[model samples]
Target: MRSITRFITTSDIVRIALGWSAFGALLLATPLLSPPVPAPLLITALVSIVAVILVCAFGVVRQAEALARRLGDPYGSLVLTLSIVLIEVVLISAVMLGPGEHATIARDSVMAVSMIILNLVIGLALLLGGIRHRGLAHNRTGTSAYLAMLVVLIALAFGLPALIGQDGAYTTAQAIPVVIVTLALYGFFLFRQMGAQADDFTEIDERLTLRAITSTEPDAAAPGIRDVLREHRTEILTRLGLLVVTVIPIVLLSHDMAALLDDGLARLGAPTALAGVLIAAIVFLPESITAIRAALGGEVQRVINLCHGALVSTVGLTIPAVLIIGMPTGQAVILAETLPDLMLLTVTLLLSISTFAAKRVTAMHGAVHLALFAIYTIVLFS
Candidate 1:
């Protein structure tokens, strides 16, 4: 029994691999099975949600030690950004293709995107990071700059569409130009992140090391990247395999998940805004769990980077991808006036105020954010 207990080690990597395999199997088999609508849909949604969670867990564990080794501040941020936004894009695309007669699908999508980034992503990150680190000190200048750009982008991309209306004089020709320009601006931001400008925003110190947060043995020998990669070659390859396997399942499961959500919302007399919120939640689930864990473990830097990075990537990458795809298809992907949009905006404003008001986040703050999340859930269910 003791030996068996010892053998039952719960490694994050192992769990993630199993999850990816399960999701891949489900994705490949679901369509072939063609299960009934509501049941299949619910199952698909659950599977997708689980798959995302597993993928995130895999990313966190695989990257955690490595992130601590090199590029300390900015490491987890990229992983979070890439993973969350990719999930968001997949879910959004699936939903848009589903049979939802709502003409303002694009608007709701944007609103959902905004709320998830601000409230779920940022709020939870701050809450958890604050709780773990007595006070997580972020670069105020970077935070301010990000907030400013975010506000402007939201105003231009999300807020303006509601006022403009779907049938407004701005035809496809006019909209196409705006999207192209937005894409170009995003390109510039991407360039800056990968270039010298990033140096201005990111700072690193030995004090910011993971060793400072978690009670782990510090590696005395600092190995080179090549050596490290060689040592972990199998792990890295496993992660890559896991990522591909997991993503396919998410896409497949999302098809029915979208339909069931729409049906469930309709049957329950829920608001259209609920759809957007659901999409955001599904996509952000994995990242959210990672952030929470890091926060509890007192890794504030990872929390901040992951949360803020995800917010930026969602808007910068996922939103543009949707627009680009929508344009060629002649789909009106502009933000339109909707209750969900207002709710999303309100959540964002509230998050900005809460996070900025006190540079230090505590358990109490986490409770408040969680309370807000509860309220959101209640509103959706009600």
Candidate 2:
């Protein structure tokens, strides 16, 4: 009785209550969400869905980090980024297919993610980490490798379309080649990332080891070897189960969220781009939290890995997939950004190139990136 009571605190109960209530709301409200019922009700439902998504996503991030802790190094960062990117892809796909005028949603979401990671996540990570540690060091080769690939992929997937395509749009035939190129880039990177160049993604951080041990333990006292094994096995299984359980609702609720978002944004006369920003923000919440925590804990390289790796996956994998889907369905995949957005992207890439040029990062670098992010936010809403 003491153990059970100790395990279930007020915080745990609140989380459970909120999760279940959100699940119930989603199931009950999904039927009426289509065609978008009255505005007031729709707003309420939208708020509920978004709120639930944030909660569920938070749960997924916590579990994913638990899994990452056990896995270690490149694989740890890889798992976290892949999990978050999967959610991003699923959410964007749902929005694309749902009822509403969201033709450019995929493009907007992808671009939003790129900017958010490069500017917002990286900015905060570097700033806070530098402030805490004075400066942070990472594998320069690894950081450079990620940045090089990102520049190329971002250029091909986003910049090229604006420069050569018709009115910043890629036709089916044009898109086919771009899609192939992007996928090939991703495959090559994946091959090298997992094998020959794996070291490039790893960092020498003692903190990660300590963090993993603490997070994996279910109780305070140490156990016998056999008990330890059993506990480790139980922890892995529990995390895996929770990961799937939480992720499913996130995906399922996403469709409903997308519907509500599309209708609500249009009615409020919000910018179409704002829909993408909001969706990207939601999708990024988990990853942002994980990265920030890593930075604060002196695991700066992991922050770079998660933020940069996510950008690569977004452009390399998500963009290609979205384009492939759009080509067959005659949906126009808008890959180009407006002048201001493009300028921000260019500045971000340049700053990143300069920031990671060395193995060390300072507060000044972070401050510069944060300033760019500030400009980005102002322009986005203004």
Candidate 3:
């Protein structure tokens, strides 16, 4: 037992490596294996896709926990955002390139993304955080700013596309310009986020000091920049390495998962919109677990930052990437015309109202969110 615990085994690394390797193989095989299978057989494909996502989710959570321990919240936020965007990009790209089954596929996808983040991600995070901390306190300024940015970005990337589709003026030529400008704007935002301008937009939670799980003490009067860099060099490298290792497998698994989802959805007659929702779930699973942990540990600020920050990142970064990529391909991803967007809009507004009204969440709130999630599922199938 002692030997097993203390020594590193080649078999363990092999197992980890094989899991990812198999995923890569599957991704490569999927396009080649375009044999028209029966709808019932697609069930197996769906299960396999879900399994890949589960493995991806588990790996992400473990790596994110390690990152959170070392780099504090800002860097951790970057990790979460990158993972979600990568998955979204992969899934969207695959669906757009695949059979042109759903005309409003992109619209459904964007709506599904919004619903999953607001109704499921934010809802569950707040609920779990509330239950853990009783009455949690987060940075109101950060939350409000994030919400405003999310609304604007979503309106631009998703809402405008839907409206354009309705006007029947969303030509491939027009789409090319839209995508170019959108990508440029996203690039600018990303640069600002990682540059000196970050300080102007970002606000550190006061409550972060109150719940210092593994963060270093804020040295307002302490060392020089050189001293700080030298002291944390090893830690920074380790965190970066962890993130890189985690992201490689995540990308591989996501690629395979995308192919499997296409096969499964085609086989099962499932709505393609559900694809975005599934991708959102997989991407958010790790962050959701972290949010629950922070809430339980009385780190409400962390929960809020994670939940809202991820939502904003998904909208701002991922949607733009999809639009930019899909526009050139002649894939006009639009919202579903079957149901009023008003219903989804109302749910999101209700969730925001509930979250802000009390500034806390509880098990009851979780139940409510779960109920809404159930309603969403029902609507999808119906």
Candidate 4:
């Protein structure tokens, strides 16, 4: 009884109830969205679906966090990153497979996520964390490894196609090799990240470690990751199970949500790129919060793992999946960015290299990143 009480609290029950209810609502409401509906009904459906997805995403984040904290370091971060990416993949795939010309959704969503995580999320993390704790320290080795992979992957996934005049898509001859290479490179990174070079992703600066150790008093409200591990000591499998249940509804519900989003946006005459931004925001909303919290807690390395690691997976994995899906569906998967956006991405990547080149980051770094994000927003709207 005590174990049950500890594992499933009142809040858990409430979230679970809402998640399942949302699942049912999606089934019933999806049909209504197939054809034109009254504005009130459309708004109601959109609002409800958005709410359900958000609620369940938070629940999923909670479970994933428990799992991540319990496992520790790279493993824990890996779990959370992979779980979020899975949800992203499902939502993007759902949107792609839906009606209308969504060929570029995969590309746009990936681009939006890269900007949001790299600039917006990481920028805020550094700024807020720096204010509270002077400079945000992280493992430069791991960060460099992640950036190197990203530069190469981004060039291959987004740039090469454009350069070769494929216009964001590769011919069958080109795609086969690209997919195989992307997957293999990602597999290599994973092997190193989880195996031989795992420490690169989780290493803490020696001075920071000593400071944490010598500190006599710790904040009670801001419990460290260790506290979470002890609390969820025996709930690994249980939490993992809960994670799946929560993620499933979001995945299924996304199909309907994507449909409504497309129809609504068309009616409103909003820019189509906004759909990608919205999807990216929705996909990573909870996870971004989790990263920021980690940042504020002075877990800069963990924040890196979550934010940088996520974009790595986002590009490494998403591109291949999009390519594969495009191959079969005969849909033109436009992965190329416009020249201006490409320039922005290149600057962001270069800036990222400098941001983490030093062992510690200051508030200024964060501001620069956020500035870049602002520029991205302007470019997006323009």
lDDT for 73 in candidate 3 is: 52
Report the C-alpha displacement of residue 331, candidate 3, in angstroms: 4.7
lDDT of 4 by residue, 94-197 (tens): 66777888777777778899999999999999999889889876888889999999999999878988877366678878888989999999999999987788
**TM-score of each candidate?**
0.71, 0.80, 0.73, 0.86
Tell me the tens digit of each residue's lDDT in model 1 across 230-252. Answer: 77556544444444444444434
User: In candidate 2, which residue ranges exceed 4 Å CA deviation?
Assistant: 1-21, 30-51, 94-101, 205-238, 251-255, 258-270
- Ranked by TM-score, the better of candidates 3 and 4 is 4
- The 0-to-1 C-alpha lDDT of every candidate, in the order given, reads 0.57, 0.75, 0.59, 0.81
TM-score preference between candidates 1 and 2, better one = 2
* Candidate 1 local distance difference test against the native: 0.57
Candidate 3, 263-371: lDDT as tens digits: 6676679976566567656656667777667667766656656776676665555555555655666555553234345465566655765665564556576667767
Judging by TM-score against the true structure, name the best candidate: 4
Q: Which regions in candidate 1 have their CA more than 4 angstroms from the true location?
A: 1-71, 90-103, 168-170, 199-255, 262-276, 343-347, 357-359, 364-368, 371-382
Candidate 3 similarity to native, TM-score: 0.73
Give candidate 4 misplaced runs (Cα > 4 Å): 1-6, 34-37, 94-101, 203-205, 208-234, 251-255, 263-269
Residue 333 displacement (Å), model 1 = 2.1
